[model samples]
Target chain A: MSEKVLMKGNEALAEAAIAAGCKHFFGYPITPQNELTAHMSKRLPKIGGTYLQAESEVAAINMVLGASAAGVRAMTSSSSPGISLKSEGLSYLAGSDLPAVIVNVQRAGPGLGGIQPSQADYWQATRAAGHGDFKLLVFAPSTVQEMVDLTGDAFALGDKYRMPAIMLSDGILGQMMEPVVMPKDSIARIPERPWAACGHGDKREHNVINSLYIEPPVLEAVIKARFEKYRLIEEKEQRCEEYLTDDADIVIVAYGASARISRSAVNAARKEGIKAGLIRPITLWPFPTKAIISRIGNAKTFLCVEMSMGQMVDDVRLIVNGKRDVRFFGRTGGMVPTPAEVLGELKKIKGGI
Target chain B: MLTIVCGHYGSGKTNFAINYALDKAKEGKRVMLADMDIVNPYFTSSEYSGILISNGVKIISPTFATTNVDVPSLPASFHSIFETNDEVVIDAGGDDVGATALGRFSKKVKEKGYEMLYVTNMYRPFTSNADDSVEMLRSIERTCGLKATAVVNNSHLKGLTNASTIIDSLEYAKDVARSAGLPLLFSVVPRSLIDQLPKDEYFYQADVYVGTIWEKGED
Candidate 1:
């Protein structure tokens, strides 16, 4: 049996990256997510891995892009404002179709928001992480154990799809501590990238990793292929957790820190003779549209709970397509809505209060 | 009996504190695990609230330690730990800033006649050598105004830790303990590596009972 270890979310993610066979880490220090960089600095060196604290988040992300092109599992992590700086690098990574892990331990945003946990970056991560006609495989982890498991999964999925994967976490998940049963003596085996830019030598012809095409039609063709890949991801990658939605009349849709609190609220509502259930989106990009569509049968109304001002609520409304009324309850600017607050929203939706 | 654990950051003070409290509770001692960390918001013993409550070990930490609030405020309820007759374990924050918070309770801790243990992961930045370790210990002592009663070897490679890592850190830890004139109480070993450890070495098995703030349920 694997022994459980009490580890903080950031430290666990750093270790998870190491366990996933990541040999290179490049990141800049930022609040709420700085522990991750510190942990990587300590652990990466012991394993003969490279841990470079880049001058800026931009420089760090570009370094990850370079490492990925060189055919190595590399990663970079930061909080909200830092992630925004990495946006251009992300677009390039997507355009170049390189696989690397990018972790965003989210904090309140809009511009140097407080260093508290918030899910305001939901749109930024899922809708358009970087400016381009591209999509990323975003994994949202609600628990510290999930932070470990999802991070490893992000690497796997990134390598499988040959694109950047965002491990979307909040300050809460990034800094909180949890008991995680690590896979004992587990070694990650990511297949060798034949197209890596490592010197071709005499083995084969030189491989190129570039996103630039001056010609309009060539760029269009390349973009078409990328969308085809995204279509497959949308079909196979939608992940979520549904709790008691089977016989629920009201369903709460939330993710990340909000979902954990929503679970508590669901349980509280159930004890009050109200049939409240929760649907937590594990992968925000693929969005879990099918899960919401399937739950419309028993659920008459849906409440979207977020730590942001109705960011994910749009997705819930879009997925439901007005079949049922979608209401939103949020606490933005680093304010975390408690179970009691969520339960009050649930009662309001059900007209029981 | 009161046992307080203090150390620098990345030194595994939280881990040693949790395990020691659990051990005392398992032995039928009324245990209270109090988190004296008001400095570092990211890591603290307060995250183990559920596990402590489940194991019948009481906890006293800042009410908003797990929240996003950066307020360096400690609640009045914290002083109750000193008033209780139960065995209390204080998990002090790392460095002088963290130790300063522990300094506030040192008078009460002294009045109660408690034991303070300074944990060290020699692999940490400043404490990589015995001299530096002793120096950091003195800094902690100066901040807390109470001397550490013992030294615990908790050295590891953060997450890439293995049996060899533990074995390698033992000598360095012993050196630190010797220089500081403290007993090398016990080296903390991950449970999985216990059987693989050298039988001659003294050690304590630590089952990780804490997780990050996001981990919210009882283990």
Candidate 2:
């Protein structure tokens, strides 16, 4: 029943948000992602939803916090610089356990590096971005369709766990135009948030939504409880996509745009009679580590391709535990390695690794 | 010296600033390209940083700030660089609202004595005529708190643009520049269509062009 339409990754994300019953959106314009804000700006009003272009990314995320606290499905988005501004809010959301969706259509960065597609923020998105020890449910989408599908899943996961969820995409995924199927009307309505700051109205005692737990023991207990929830998430929510891995000799592990590039490289390697396959992590934080580790007995080598200079390679190395030979190919600061480049690297690794 | 480029959307503002920064860096001048555009997704100067950085040009963009509820602090070195460096190029965003961020540093920039050029492409939206161009300029001036020192006419109709279209747009922008008391900086004559135009008045123009757009098959 899904209707197919050609859309950019940003537009698909906005549509998915709407379909997921997110009624509030706050964001500022930033490259590789303005289409998301623009789409929300146009459609949210018609659907009786609120859309505000906050003065800055900081204000936008805080606005999302306020909306999320009000028991409404709310979201915000940005590129690298803007996401940097929202990191504090994300930590606060994670600390407070407020369920919200944050879409980061990542662009190149160390500083305001570039607007081109980049997966450099993998560490920032997967690990604790802000000061405290907290994790965002990170979903990495390889295609525009996945961007739409995962945005809905991101909101669902956030609401289910009462935590922040991030659609960790790069500029290429955000801006590239592709065909996407709009979810059918049979999509489930999100349940009302019990922890939200909807008016108490003498129904019960006042509820406070805050990350600040002053007492050390009480804070420690809260963090321990949060970690338990993360453990549960790790057990149940580790999602990944595997292709042609049954008899493959070498496995290429990647995510987001890099996954798409790695897929092409795998296909090229297969044509040359090398048994190569791809294992793409859809959820970064609940990183399909167990699945990857399970494949290690059969796979001889693993190649980690990323847009950053070896950020995700560490994770692959950790999962493989040095049992399998691991190699890396990457391009930093907004440069996307062509499929040919990735294929050439695979050729170099075919016999050696 | 800082060379700031400002313009409407799709005016090739980023394109000019990026190539100019690269050119200066090639000339052995330490150049830095700062992208201040927070609007418009398709075009911005920050996209060229990888190439510029590899070529030894210092590229500063807004992407460095972390997402937090608080206003993220910028690097301390940025301010020091302007005081010490001989060459700097700031590529402001397309819309007037995007250009407003430059106002925060306008006083410091003026103290440092930098030149700001307003890039005008008559074929673009909101600046197709003299009145429209003037209104756009006034909005930019109000936002930045400084008047544009010069105007660079960079007219094009996307893929359909020709030399005549460029000439006509330049004429329209020239009138606006005269009335605003700003110097007509130069025209961007694409090398592909450069030979078709008369070389009399625009002979001294800097042929502002970037290599063909990076398509998938080129590499």
TM-scores for candidates 1 onward, in order = 0.74, 0.65
Model 2 chain B: worst 10 consecutive residues (lDDT sum): B65-74
Tens-place lDDT digits, model 1, residues A251-341: 9999988898888888888988899999999999889999999998879999999999899889889889989988899999987888888
Tell me the lDDT of model 1 at B93.
Answer: 84
Chain A, candidate 1, TM-score of 0.98
True contacts kept of 2: 0.03
What DockQ does predicted model 2 obtain? 0.04
Off by over 4 Å in 1: B1-39, B42-91, B95-115, B119-147, B150-219
Which candidate achieves the best DockQ against the true structure?
Answer: 1
Q: What is the TM-score of chain B in candidate 2?
A: 0.84
How do the residues A304-337 of candidate 2 rate in per-residue lDDT, one tens digit apiece?
9999898888888988988999999999877788
True contacts kept of each: 0.15, 0.03
Q: In angstroms, give how far residue A200 of model 1 lies from its true place.
A: 2.6
